[model samples]
Target chain A: MDNQTKIHIKNLNLHIGKQQILKDINVQIPKNKITVILGPSGCGKTTLLKSLNRLTDIYPDIKVEGSIEIDGQDILKVKKRDVTDIRKKMGLLSQRPYPLPMSIYKNITYGLKISGRRRKRFLNKRVEHYLKQASLWDEVKDRLKDPASALSIGQQQRLCLARGLAVDPEIILADEPTSALDPVSSQAIEEKFVELKERYTIVMVTHVLRQARRIADHVVFMYLGEVVEQGSAEEVFGNPKEERTKAYLRGAFN
Target chain B: MKRFFKINRKIRNTFHKRWMLLSLIVVIAMPIVLGVGLYLKSAMLLEQTSLIKLLFSKEWKPMQGLFGLWPFIVSSLWVTILALLIAGPICLLAAIYMTQYTKKYFLRMMHPVIDILAGIPSVVYGVWGVIFVVPLVSNHLAPFFNTQSSGYSILTGAIVLAVMIIPFILNILIEVFRNIPDQLTEASLSLGATHWETVKHVLVRKAFPGIVSAFGLGISRAFGETIAVLMVVGNVTQIPKGIFQPGYPLPALIANNYGEMLSIPLYDSALMLSALVLFVVVLLFNFASRMAIIKLERHT
Candidate 1:
């Protein structure tokens, strides 16, 4: 219940069909900081990220147990209407950018318009504001009316980031958001996350150890669907208390 | 050894090339053969009355040797347009529901039923239309609208055509909707848009070209459907005054007159001309629809 804690997870468990995906998870994500969930592939990092926003609800026969309290509301117990409201409060940057089959400008404004911001001037201003925030304004300012899919993969991902931010979410859930991009685009996103940490809570999932090291303020190192270590990035990376954490940091089983 | 292998390859290549040429000629020649025959048969009619007069004039008395195609042309177009108006929205809604909203198990069950509906013979549709739809229109709809009570009319025919084409349209639209990548919907849903809103704004916009092609396919089917339409659309030759009145479409005219065409002077030629006209119109419609789909795709 600390004012600094944005999300408090307690005894979270997720099962898809007969297989357990996330086992007895518990963590605290702080406000205005980047929390990186670092693990090897298939270690449930992405599932953990998705769990925060209830995106895992789309999977069939999936059961989620325990509480994920965001802003004093246990999202698991909220009604469907309130779940949507909660989802709106969290921005999700997927691994691949899906630009809503619309013009670049419309992609940013769609969420704003749906939330009932209809003034032409307001929409125009926010479109510029968010695109700049995602660091894609200069590259795409001339093509605001063009189809978003026409952009390069890097630009598309940036556009998606701007789109997510347009909704004015308190938290940004990114699941390996730069895994599909080239290194340069990857660096651009990493820089954007570093700058955005002062304004919004960011929970990112990544299999790449280097990325986790580059941008993690808080680190949760997971293995085999269980959290092995959770602490400040410096403590976990510089001087790990757990032997498993030490092994993972040393690239024992990447 | 290399020369022997080379000769073997040459023999195989020559055989393949000859077979390809023969099949290609057969495919290309069939349509031309049919078109040529149709043109020759209609030549007599062209000689009897100018092509413009045949196409444009409304008057039609075979005994008096005046045959204008305005009535048949008008009836054919109106019936097809009406059928599309009724079927297009229903097919689109059903397709969207099946692809976007329905459970996987339910969609699996519904798909075969839709396919069977598409596979049903058109004659069966005509009979069903007569038994069920004609009465519904005459007993209920006619009384409700205060229109004429005849069970057979342009409206009745259109209703039958609409029923027959809905399944056809739905099948195409369902395929189009299914091809939309999962990431797009996930993005929309994650952004907090409702399922309906996602479908309306994202899925529909992405699938616009395919939807256009689906409608085009549906309209083309409705336009050319022969046996069932002939049975339902009351075959009077004058232009229909309203939906309740009997009308004569070109297919019904050709179907009713083709058998006795040889006995009547210029009748064979007129019937053949109508067939040719239907072919040309349907071809143009399909071609135009393809162009529209391409334009929309490029714009997106």
Candidate 2:
């Protein structure tokens, strides 16, 4: 394992029901870098992202083979008691924003309260910190008491990001975080993703190639449950690579 | 002129936009219209007792000139509360298990069983309660209280009603739990909360309105259920001292006497009055629940 490697997938395979979904996947997600997984929909980008934190284990009858490790601690071997601990170290933003049917302030501090921080001032500061980090603090600072759902779609997504950041996780897994947003909203989220990469390691799954170009430091291109190409974003996007990757970049299948 | 037909087009398009609004207004107002109409007709038939007597009437034996209904009214409330007490936890937990913990096959298996139970006639539930439940409680539960027998007791009716309404609670809760987006549950669980904690804090909280409505629906169904209560309730029309005591509900009392009303307007009026009482209770329950939901909805 490289010293900079935070998550390593070795010979990983997954099957949902009778269909083999992820096949022989091997990747090492680097620390403090924006690594974007780009692929067509249903090509297992989200599944691979979920496998890092063992979120996919919530489903029954899915067969997973090989090993996934975070900080060289094999996540699959982690017991049920430690799942939360492992999950706490990583935060996931779904494709759609679900900002908890709670007040915006409460939404940001949700992860803290259940972790047993009952102090008033500390929780308040943490809420303000993350909300600002996601760039939604200014827009929503006055309406902190209002329901998070009252915000516009873009604001809701940012609030979800703020909520994710509240836990102080080392890695943030974003599954198509901006796919559901308009271009302006998408750009807003993209800039935040770039800004946060200095402090937090981000593994993002996106269907849009342009999104990968705009934000990713490194890119992992997947097709049919296999990694076709992966490199620094500049190299992967600029230089020649696998035929399938080139075809995909050309908008051959959309 | 071309402009003339375009004005007709504009009118037609405007009507299309308003159609759903019109439909919503009509659907929402239909029940109020029906209820108000029934109330007016019943008001014409029922002689107004003073407010106190109307509410506190005891010993509702119209045949013998005792036309107070406080006993049956209290009995109905008690039985509905009891059914909720017994069925609420079981149905909700079972619904939780079905919705969250278990797989599709298990849910597929359990759902139809609940549907079949829900579909079973009230009479069948009564027969089953009398044959099996009454015996089980008398043999297993009564001895704990040092009672000789609680045959056809309040406990028996409550148990029967609970069983009858189990599917109702479970079915509606199943729908409510299912109505929540899967992402909601996943979001909570991925936050590192345990499955139980997610259910308590997220799933149940989000579905509170739906669950409460389901409960209100259950209470209304149990309150209005007659044949099942009549068969197993010991047919004693008085306020039950406790779970082990015998009791009768208003619906059961009405069902028992509905066939025997011959000529007297008071007898027919009393039955109509009781039916009107049942209608009023149901209407108030629904309206109050709707108001409560709206108030809570405003806060949410």
Best by DockQ: 1
How far does residue B122 in candidate 1 sit from its true spot (Å)?
A: 1.1
Model 1 TM-score, all chains together: 0.92
Question: What TM-score between 0 and 1 does chain B of candidate 2 receive?
Answer: 0.83
Model 1, position B10, has a per-residue lDDT of 99
In model 2, what is the error at residue B262, expressed in angstroms?
3.2
Which CAPRI level is candidate 2? acceptable
Report iRMS values in order.
1.9, 1.6
RMSD of 1: 2.5
Pairs of colliding residues, candidate 1: none
Which ranges in model 2 have alpha carbons more than 4 Å from their true place?
A: B1-45, B145-149, B261-265
- Among residues 3 or more apart in sequence or in different chains, the pairs in candidate 2 whose N, CA or C atoms overlap within 3 Å are B57-B70
> Which CAPRI level is candidate 1?
medium
Tens digits of per-residue lDDT, candidate 2, B1-300, equal 899999999999999889988999999998778667655654643455553575587766666755677888888888889988999999899998888776667888998899899999999999998999888878988887887566787788889999999998899999889888877776776677777778888788788887888888888888999999888888787878877778888898788887686465566656666777888888788877778777666655
Candidate 1 per-residue lDDT, tens place, B14-107, comes to 9999999999999999978988899998998898689989998998887777789989999998899999999999989998888776556777
